[model samples]
Target: MQPPTLSLIGTTPRMRWAWTAAGVLLIAGWVHRPASAQEPAIFRGADLKLGEELIAQHRCAQCHAEKVGGDGSAIYRPLGVINNAGLLRGMVEQCNATLNFQMFPEEVTAVAAVLNRDHYRFKD
Candidate 1:
């Protein structure tokens, strides 16, 4: 037996277009799902630009450079003691407290999210 073609199945042009559109939508949703799922809830909708600006304003790199040398990114130990996303956020909050940055909770979360995106890459 042979399979039926679109012509044999009476598929109109409009129906073909609808099927194509539905497939595209499904693919699009699938493609974007993993990224959102991987992102931590605390980091969702985080202001990356604000985080970057805050890092600069605080001279975090300069201080880290003074402490650890190089461009200061070396201070970020993605595989080191600060292992998980919660720990990463806690470390950022600890830094804020110790440095008297007085950052709000959301700001701390934003900074941690930026660090995760750039370095740590914790899926959860």
Candidate 2:
């Protein structure tokens, strides 16, 4: 026989209908996609390898996938609000703040640079 389902706090019943409703609400909150790459010289000095390592260590895709589905890449709207190098850096800062990543300035920049190379493709 199957075991009983746990609740959100581990003290209540696991309602099938409740989970479905939550999922529906999530699908209704999609954000806009940003412009991919096309940045200027500010990105010229970025370290691609370091950026890639930081992203892997932080598991950015894991979190994104959990929220937006499809391997989590859909959450990163390359052609959305982050149109330039400065904006890209700022977005990374926002993510760090929101998620309490506690990364230093260089680490944040590295992560963003890597993301730009692989996904954003912003020129610099």
Candidate 3:
């Protein structure tokens, strides 16, 4: 008493091609999506490599180590004041201004993005 089952076994070659094309399109859409599409809106298109370089050039970890001791990674408290992408970016901007790093807005965003990827993991 099994119900009728739909099967592609006897389908036309054209129908098979259409199904293949649809699957390809779906996979391509997912694969070719912009990297920013997966990141927080504020950090969209931020250059992570530049951010890493800036962090080293500015000795940010060294400064943080001086402030909080250890490797300075402790300064990045995911459960502390910075709880979102926007706040994380603002904190980087604050550092830029306070330390007179002279970083552009995009640079600040880049730094914040690296931090988010490494620590905060903020989706929004």
**C-alpha RMSD by candidate, in order:** 5.4, 18.1, 5.8
lDDT of 1: 0.89
- Per-residue lDDT of model 3, residues 82-116, tens digit only: 99999999999998999899999989999999999
User: Which candidate leads the pack in TM-score?
Assistant: 1
Clashes of each: 0, 15, 0
- Of models 2 and 3, which has the larger TM-score? 3
Candidate 2 or 1, higher lDDT: 1
Q: How much lDDT does each candidate structure score?
A: 0.89, 0.74, 0.89
lDDT of 2 by residue, 1-124 (tens): 3455544424434566667668777776543222223445565566768778878888888989899987887876778988766788899999899989898888788888777777777764
Candidate 3, poorest ten consecutive residues by summed lDDT: 1-10
Which ranges in model 2 have alpha carbons more than 4 Å from their true place?
Answer: 1-39
In Å, residue 31's CA in model 2 sits off its true spot by 41
Off by over 4 Å in 3: 1-22, 25-29, 32-37
